[model samples]
Target: MLDALIQQSVCLTQHYTGSPVCNPSRAALLTGRYSHRTGSLDTLEWWGLERLALREEWLLPLGGLAVPGDLDHEAAKEDKEREARSDVHEPSRPSRFVSFAPLRDFVFQPAALDHYAATALFLACVRRLRPDFAPTADDARHIARICRLLEGMPLGIELAAPWAGKLPLGEIADELAAGLGLLATTLRDVPPRHRSMRAAFDRSWALLSVPERDILRQLSVFRGGFTREAAEAVAGATMADLSNLTDRSRLRVEPSGRYAVHELIRQYCGERLGAEHEAEAGETAEQVHDRHAAHYAGFLRVLEPQINWRASINSEVGPETGNLDAAWRWVIEQGRYELVQAMVMGLYHIAVAEGRYQTTLRLFDAAVQRLRAQRGRGEGGAGDAPTDLLLALLLFCQGHMCIDLGLLRRAEACTEESLAVLDGIAPGRLREEQTLYTKGLVALLRSWQGEFAEALRLRGELLSWLRTTEVSVWPHVPQVGTLFVQANECASLGFLTWHLGQYDVAQGWLRESLAIREQLGEERWRAYGLRTLAGVLRTIGELEDAERLTRKGLALSEAHQDRIGIGWSHSALAATLMSAGRPGEAQSHFVESLAVAQDSGHHALLILSLNGLGALALRRGNLDEAGQLYEESRASFERLGIAGTLRYAEAVIGLGEVALARGDWSRARARFREALAARACRAWEKMDAVAGMAQVFAGEGDTSQAAELLALVAHHPFTAHATRERVEALLAELEAELPAEVFAVATARGRARELDEAVECLAA
Candidate 1:
């Protein structure tokens, strides 16, 4: 027994693997090699670079398996089909093998087996170290259970769990509780104490009072950390005695006014909520949940900004984590329009700054739902002026997101609706200059949509008004500060001019905006200015300049732990890197950008990052990877109803090329045609698609179609850099078709490698 072993032991001697992974940790654990030394920090993702599995264990002081797997690709179609078939007729519980396929494949288990022996040695040393305090039977039983667990494989322990009920009290309790609060599902035929963690947790649950039980049940509503105010709002109690209740540990007082319980206990509480509710008790159960959700939603709307103020006063000494994370989860998963909008607005605005133009769509959609619901019940409309302000602001926010995705028509509709509501409201609320700011935003978006004349005219109007008005002197203030209004107006003007081919003017405005942002310090709104400034500079072919600016923004975001901001900045930086001719770095940054965007639920930015990465991959001749990237980007765009993401078609063409390489001409043709169709959408998202289709057509021997397709791409009369890409692509395509005798033939990568062989040999 563990207790008995601890009572009598010699000096304890145990070794820990120095490797950081099965690939990295395995080497260290077994051979004392760190990740850097072994070059296996990310070996789990690479093919053949994985840590070697413990082909030979205990070769004495060594243990642990080397991992072997590449995880990026999906399971094979045949495997999935087989699983689907098995799932239908034969319903069997998934074993750890299949349930944790990718993770299990990557983990080294042999090294774990050695940990039990080490623990045993450590326990024996502890007792020997202090003979006066002999180990108890219970202690020995617990240590014994751990040793058994380490010997068994993942499923071996899982399957043996039920037998704990059958095992004797003192027999093999070592298999049960190995780590404090880090319980594993021990399934071996061990004794009751070693049998299962479920029993242990159940024992803990039976000890709480009704009030404490109620607190636990209510807290389950929150999935993340919750604040004290939020707890007060959701827990169905805010009595004066609550603090006393918390102090006694019956309730929990989270840091920064936020609280948390173990995830396992939360799940238990959820089960209790289900069991206690009656079948027809919709009001009894769901209503309470709805009220709870609403309260949390309102709390989120208020608390987020309040927390910022508290942190701003002293972020280093900011209030405890009381319940903020809980509020975040509440907004993230269950929020209605108000809460989600507040949450999005409250974020670091990295999404907007870094060019996560696509991710804000979910919040926009929620706002739409809110608007529709309000309208359906006629809560606020034309005559209801007070309510109309909020309604109009919500619509405006949605329109901004729509504009980000190139959904011009939908965006226009939203803008128009908000303006109509604006017209209906009294003259005293938001500023007149602010209205012009919106007008300018819509105008430039219209230009991007190809309504050049209308857009130009609107831009003129907005700029003229802004120049004429010294400052906002409105009797009533707009919700946003004057500084924000100025920054937004300037950024919008820069964007419009940049697209309209006025590089000098656009750059000037962007510079001013960026300068203003630099002075204002770090905040979500300022991040918007920083990102837009970088984007505008990039458009003017100042890629290096853009890179620095974007990275500056990214650094600020990192300092603030702004997930949305970091994602946005990294994405833009990737594009900047690509434009600066750093494909390898760009590719890596873009992938990380997309991952961050996906994790943050910023769909818009994820779409852009994916498409950008796909383009780089295609350029690098990784056509399979390119296609996957494009497909993923396209899905993100489509799912969020973010239209005008046809630029992803560039990768679709790459897919066609890959198909062509594999001798699948039919598939190649299909991909080419699809790319062409999407590219025809005419937004910037289609630029890559258009160029790609031309390349495909040239490759397929249709020079005339390729030339005609190429005609759509024109030289930017204003700037040499803008037209350089088109010229280069045409030359490369022509060369690809030439006979070796007439001219060298090669693909894009080949052309890059051998410049002489890559271009068409036009007559001198």
Candidate 2:
């Protein structure tokens, strides 16, 4: 019966009951002969009963039999030889071999379950563990989080699901966040290694060689994924070790060719790195961290020129943001001021473009504090221009960040301190350039404070000096010569002139700045110039051109992932849409700008977005919503101590329009008067206020006064096309109401009034 079964390719093997050991029985089953005849022995001695004779293979046909039995090392070697012989003779039936181990178990496969599948698996396990439990929406979310934290490992999910009976899902998630020990089961029916996440991880951990373990420990220092080069440099991982570890599923290779360890596994390795014995070379965790920091510092140094001069819009710093931030904190902790100084400017530009104002402010503030403490200790060398220069630059950069955050008072103090630090430095080309840069930041601060005239004067003087003076190239870097400063000054002049309602002059200055920026390949500055010029064009009623330029800027900003630039571009585009009478589209962009502003803590942009939303609401005839949004904008500007800004005036004018719609004549006049009195209210915005005042006068039956204000606004050269059209419509209405001769006289008198006279009439 056994021979017929073997001949039919259904061979079975088992330990013989009479034998004291299983090896002899296993050898007989493999060779279909007596153990002694096959050179297999039952004696427990060196090389006994472990191997079958290499020449014997009579149990079953190699290609057609399913032989189910354990094959030790020597027995497996003999089987392979016999199988090869059989393959050569048969010429058609090829033998195959497949091996399985706990390390390559199905539960540990590389492919993770998707979200829905993971959730269903978790819930199913939970139901099996506690049949009466029902999951809530919050429970589902927490389960999803737990699955993500565990990398969707099946045994991990099964081990964690039992805890749902003892703790809330959120608490279970919190416990998992604290450590991986929460993923353990007390169920005795399960296998020992399968019952706990740690045991399973230990099975894999024990398989790694000493060098592989050391490399993994070092790799724990990385926060996000790392490139092969970074892994080799920081962790001392050779290609063979990385490949071996990856094959064992110890590290995962991302689609982008970066490598990452599971977060739970990373935590485990990090703990071992912190507490384990020193490696063969006596390298400590601190030493590994130092290497990590040094590598990234050098990395940033290599990319610094590109970040500063060429690649501000789309720099290589994005992928390494996590690593760079970690490296920055480490250097700051170690008081490695020189390394910090080397990477500060590049990091500053990155923070500005990405709208990480608050985070970068804290980092730079810490750096400044550390430097000040070092100075107090007298640790700095004598005539330390580099140290002082770093301090000055940090202060100037911090001031710019503060301006973005609407902390104008702090910005002013920072600028003052930066200038004072520059004064202490010995007069040289470096000091001269730094001083000029700091003054430009101060001018920007003044403009934000609604002191446009002062900003304009400072920028004009800077531009003249930069253009006329012969700025020799620095010994180290010659790329950032006087031309860069001249371009910055010209951009500043354009911004100030725009705020002052000189649209044509603003356009000319912005175009010149853009030409220089293009020549220098400053894509970021070019995008900014395009957006500003678009605003000018929009105000002049060139809607098609304005939209085109605005979209181009938007595309550039989106491509660079520049959050601030994107928000500003959206706001600019929305304003153009509002002028073009597309309220629905305008509202959507305004909402997008508001969201970005809120997320980035950009206070100025937030206020601007609110004012824009208010305009859209007023256009849609939602008077109450418009009033509320305008009031919020006005209050925010007041709280920020920038109530004199043109934005605040615009908000006030919006409220006046709301009142005019409601026929609240007294409230309308009051709002218009407040707007006209704002110091930053330039010619076009003042004309808007005058138009509101004229409507109020007409509502109160003062026809002659209303006609005069409307005519005055229509005749102003700086009046925007949109405002002028509205004023003309109001004047025509007044002409229809009044007698012909009386209307003609009122119009002539109003057209003769100067801008200042018109503003005074509105204020009265």
TM-score of each: 0.53, 0.76
Tens-digit lDDT string for candidate 2 (1-764)? 34543443321322121221222211112212225555543221111111222335222112111111112332222222222120111111111111222211222232211223344556656777688766654565466556655544444556777789899987886677556788777767555665666776677677777888888888887765678899999998988888777765577675567776766677678767887826543878888888888988888777766553454424356556657776887888898878897778767877787676776787788888987787778777434688888888899999999888888889999999899878878888777777877998988887876789999999999889887876552213466567766777788788888778888899989999989877877666677888889988887899999999999988777766676888888899999999999988998888778777766667768877999999888888899999999999898877877786646688899999999999999999999999988877766788889889889989999999889878988987778889999889888888898999999999898899887866875687
Error of 1 at 648 (Å): 6.0
Sliding window of 10 residues with minimal summed lDDT for model 1: 755-764
lDDT by residue (tens digit), candidate 1, 22-139: 2210101122222545543212110011122233421221221221111211222112111212011111111111122333222223322223333333243233434453335444
Instruction: Name the runs in model 2 displaced over 4 angstroms.
Output: 1-200, 308-315, 381-383, 468-480, 638-641, 757-764
Report lDDT (CA) for all predictions.
0.47, 0.70
Best by TM-score: 2
Global Cα lDDT for candidate 1: 0.47
Per lDDT, the best of the predicted structures is 2
